[model samples]
Target chain A: MSDAEIAVRDLTIRYGQHVALKGASFEVRPHEIFGIIGPANSGKTSFLKVLNRMDTFTAGMHFEGQVEVGGRDVRAWRNLYALRRQIGVVFPLPVGLPLSVYDNVAFAPRLAGVRAKADLNVIVEGCLRRAALWDEVKDRLNALGSLLSGGQQQRLTIARALSQKPRILLLDEFSIAVDPVTTMRIEAVLSELKAEMTIVLVTNLVQQARRLADRTAFFLMGECVTVAPTEQFFLRDADLDPRARDYVEGRFG
Target chain B: MSAPPPHPDTAALDRRDLAWYVDKLVAVLVFVGGVSAVVFIVGIFAFVTHEGWGFVSEHFSLRGFFGSIRWAPTSTSNPTYGALALIAGTASVTGLAMLVAVPFSLGAAIYIAEFATGRTREVLKVLVEMLAAIPSVVWGFIGLSVMNPLIIDVFNVPIGLCVLNSGLILGLMAAPIMTTIAEDALKAVPDTYREAAEALGATRWQVTRRVVLPAARQGLLAAVLLGVGRGFGETMAVLMASGHAINLPTSPFDSVRALTATIAAELGETAVGSTHYQALFALGIFLFVVTFVINLSADLIVRGIRKT
Candidate 1:
């Protein structure tokens, strides 16, 4: 009944005796910028890792969940690679690959069998431009990516992710270490990218979630207290639940 | 303000202060040790270059140095002392060792460092360290006992001490160095790189081939350099396995002598003030320079990776 691009039902994650997420459920709307806001150690990373099937929870520490992206159960998909190709990710830290600037962006497409030089050039340039990194690094495509500044490195990482031409982009604190100006630049880029890709942001900063998210999910103690449109979630949280009221009133995290 | 907290705090500080002073002293000692290592290496290069310049630069010395195949520097009739025999031996042994050792050692290293975990990784590290600790003389004794007979009789390769035997010894000797260095390089790679590759749905082998190895390129080069240097500089194992022949080895089955062995073999009996003695010294120069160049190349490669 919901027009959700991604639907999570009966989601639960446990790390040994510690429960990370209790029976969590949420719907991510298509092409919407969805923000996940939680304090440190609140299972944001664990949840994101599960979504990508990157979590290696011990056998006993099971995740009881169903995650469907584009109406296909993510776990049941016959080809995980095909699913991944449609959803790009930028990690919390800038994972600048040990490759030349151009190759970092060229890697995925090449792996996916886009071997034509002309197509590669177009893809790399377009992604870099979308990442707002083209003008600075256009002349140094052959240089090692590690030589770039922290901000530039993050942009390059974003460019690399974009090269996958994903329908969904997952960002985990993409601007955490960069300068404020660069953070704003990335936020602007995400604003534009949302028209083409469903953007999911995991952040600790409330102001950031309010600025960029169309809908926001507030998590506390491994539970989603509520998730609603950004304006309603922030303005109408006082009467929703005690935890939500305290969190919204700034009395607690 | 501090006086108010003088109950238990002052005594705690007094205890910690002593530990802090000792820690500072330990840090100073470590700093001095690091600098001394640098000074020691630099001094050796400077001293060797200063002493061996005449031989290194001399046209006659260098020509007779690398171009000939002579080992009887003490032979009264004709003291032949050309480095060709030694260079040929070193090159053959090192090349063979690399061919056999590089792929196997790197594969094992990648398996242990990137793939293995828990008790398996710990066991691998312990095994590698133990192998490295096994003394050179023990390796020489191994070649003399277990390896020597196998080559001549069981293996039935002609010239029991030949390029093949020497190569096998060098390969085994270089294994620990290769695995340890290569594993270190692989470990130095950030875990995030692997995670990113995996998140992109790359299989284990594909991730290793495409992401891990390329990221660990500088370290892998260093690892290879360390392996080659160990094999080239190794004297006793090669001496025991090689037939000490001065001629060119035509194949793996043929006998050959390397430079390190020649130096070891000739240095003891060369009479003082004889041309044979000087020529042996010249061989020492060649061995020293070659090892230095290998180590230098490793340093340059690591630097090149950093600059980019």
Candidate 2:
């Protein structure tokens, strides 16, 4: 559809001779939280990497088929950096980037040529606030980002991901290293973020998808088994794929 | 029916076997091998100090030895042991060599660590190691035969062997080890740092300069310091390239004699227990101390990186 922010067609990814994901097709709509749930080795992370062209540096990683974002083929972009700047990604574990907490949030903005200190301070404060980390680290913004606690580092990473004002945000298991309280806090932040940018959330928690995602996709053994609205997806219905139902019901993954 | 469990006393889990004896023996042997390095270093230091102690107490004057430039150890009339000219010669030549080597070695290291990949990186690394393994005498030969006439023709100086020649030779001699250490430093930086920076839309150069370089700065400093230490201790190449005239050089074209070169050139001619011989031993002590301090500080700086 014209409104779709990301459109994938027959996307297959491989590492050397082994296929990581095969024959997948989907579309992510604008201003919506799209959740992808799968067990380990189901290619959720690989799919996220392809969105920002991280595959370029990953040796032996190959992908076939078209992935279009903003009505253009991702592979057709001559300047991959520009393409990546439009998309933000957060990894499973926190990456605090051997820099100060303030610098971590300001990194992307500085790369985009924001030079004035006052402007940087404003952007950093705003992103940190949005990530719900400002109150905790406001006084110690100059401290090393890596020195922060695990939960704080994850939030700092989220703040950094937000600094670019990206059109799409790809998060891979943002709650893995976060405490339950911090996870709930971040989940609230994501709900607010969906009003501004599209989010592709890959999570192991099925109920988390229920709590946040507007629509959800089920990936099983490297295949896209089904995609449905969050409400109907969890319902035990004849139309629902039995494999997805079994996975969501915790029978087997 | 299930088999009967083995009795605890009969099992004898703690009993020593042939492998245990071999392990203990190997451990003792390796411990001695490791301790021998420290032992040898201490022994050498003790010997140098013992030889130089007589000169220090009986004939040594701190001012004449350090301040005066005239190094007339053989003159029966005065026999002054001034080493200022030699010290300045060593300092100046090493300074110039660092000027020549730092940029070259760092550039090569960055290229190998960040840009080159696969077969190219492997081949370049092997070649650098091979260069490091080249004997100092061979490098001395290159300086004597190739660089001598070339420097004379290019600079229009009367003497081909001068600070310029020796510094250039020394620079080339030190570059291989410096490059190797610097590459190791860069390699020590985690790939995650590079990937994170790259994912944030930073260019490759930006990633290297902003992320990787800052992360590896301590190790890089250690690499440069180790190169300086190597320059201070090198003998054959500097002796061959330097003109061996003791002088306070005002320019790179002026001929000079290094401290290491002086010990190497005249150590054979002096009689036993002679003041001139003892003075040379004093110089040896000085060189040993300077090199030791440099290497120790470099090691400490590298350890600082690990602590962080």
Candidate 3:
């Protein structure tokens, strides 16, 4: 109702016989940071993967119900390339393709049909700057991306995702390997980027959701328990589910 | 406070010692097996060089080795030990074989790794492996019986036993090795890389060409190098398929003798310790060096890839 950029209605995901996501319904509004928080095996990362159809790469993944991205059903979209171009994903562990830092960021733009070196240079620098990585990597752009520190590599992954100029960015536990300082820096960067695109941030840390998310969804045992404004949920209103409150308060996973 | 007393686990320690000793014994046995390979190779190298040293010291000249044009080693009065023709023959045939195999092997590897799935992929992989198991003599026989006549009919050559015939046979023999190694290299690439490429809107082919190939570049190079080594060392196939004429082939159609073929054809009959016999050993030495360098480089490339 509030001009959702992505809408999922009764979505369920399974890998072989095991259900990873069960009957989840949610909406992410445009230009807002939507946070998902849950314990292990709660389908948080799985939900992020389904946004860009990244789950198709895995074998025997089954999905039911509907997922609409930018007002079009993802299942009905014939052009997978066009669909993927609109949504970008950063994996939990930063996998910078064993290439130079510049090439890692430029890879998406080149695939998106930008061939000119000058054009790629501008886009690469702009995205790197936006990811808070330009300052550290500006001098050694030719160095291999795999050679970067954990935090820098995570930021490089962010820059790579931003290079596609996606309508929505999906992050899966991006700070799992990052130090606290770098995590805070990336949070600030994401906050600034939300003016241009919607962001789906899946975190194991509830405090991260409390700090950065405009709206938050709490998932428990493959089910979405509740979706509410971050302030309302964290302030412990009577409407909040007990399990969600317990999880947010660190009473138990 | 004093440190806590140690627990009584002497019996457990004794049992662990027994297991450790057994592990050490097995490790030492494997180590010996590994060292034996080096010992045998060094022994072979010593024997070949020792056997060829007399001819090398007396009759070996730079002019006859690299500069001379003819390779007639059986002349009664004036036997020429010039190997430029044989070396050129080996190069041309191996080059042609590589030319035929590289594209096909790489294409098959790409298909197997990127396109083929499930049973189709398994079948294709097994077929390629089975191709490697086929004896070289069988391949040579096929070249002689089927391919020769086909070549003659297609090209109108008087005799089909030429460099081209041997090259084609060698290419077929080498393709399986190339494909297996290259496919392994492609498959070794992580799925995360593919997913990363796809999430950025790259098509399957684009991901393969841009990401997978570049990532596997070193491994692919090692594969090609190993294929070249395999083709260069092959004896029975080239001996039976090639015309074995000791001539400098001006074109692919001309009959020529490779170093391995020359060794196979003449080494059995050459009188022991004669100039001809030693020259054959010299050719063996040359083949050993070339293949050694090729295999060593391939190993280095593979190691570098593993390190990265």
- The best candidate in terms of TM-score: 2
Shift of residue A106 alpha carbon in model 1, Å: 1.9
Q: Write the per-residue lDDT of candidate 1 for residues A32-94, one digit (tens) a residue.
A: 999988777777777786676666412345578887888877788777777777778888888
**Which candidate wins on lDDT?**
2
After superposition, the stretches of candidate 2 with alpha carbons farther than 4 Å from their true spots are: B1-16
- Score chain A of each prediction against the true chain A by TM-score and list the results: 0.93, 0.98, 0.97
**What is the docking quality class of candidate 3?**
medium
The positional error of residue A193 in candidate 1, measured at the CA in angstroms, is: 3.8
Which has the better DockQ: candidate 1, or candidate 2? 2
Which sequence of candidate numbers ranks them by DockQ, best first?
3, 2, 1
Best-to-worst ranking by lDDT? 2, 3, 1
CAPRI quality of model 1 = acceptable
User: In candidate 3, what are the lDDT values of residues B1-308, reduced to their tens digit?
Assistant: 99888867757755656779899999999999999999999999999999999888999999988788677778998888889888888888899999999999999999999988778999999999999999999999998998889989999999888899999999989999899999999999998899888988899999999999999999999999999999899988888778888888888889888999988888889899998999999988989999999999999999998887
Worst 10 residues of 1 chain A by lDDT: A53-62
TM-score of each: 0.83, 0.96, 0.94
| Candidate 3: residue B105 lDDT (0-100) | 97
Candidate 2 — which pairs collide? Answer: none
Instruction: Give the clashing residue pairs of candidate 3, or none.
Output: none
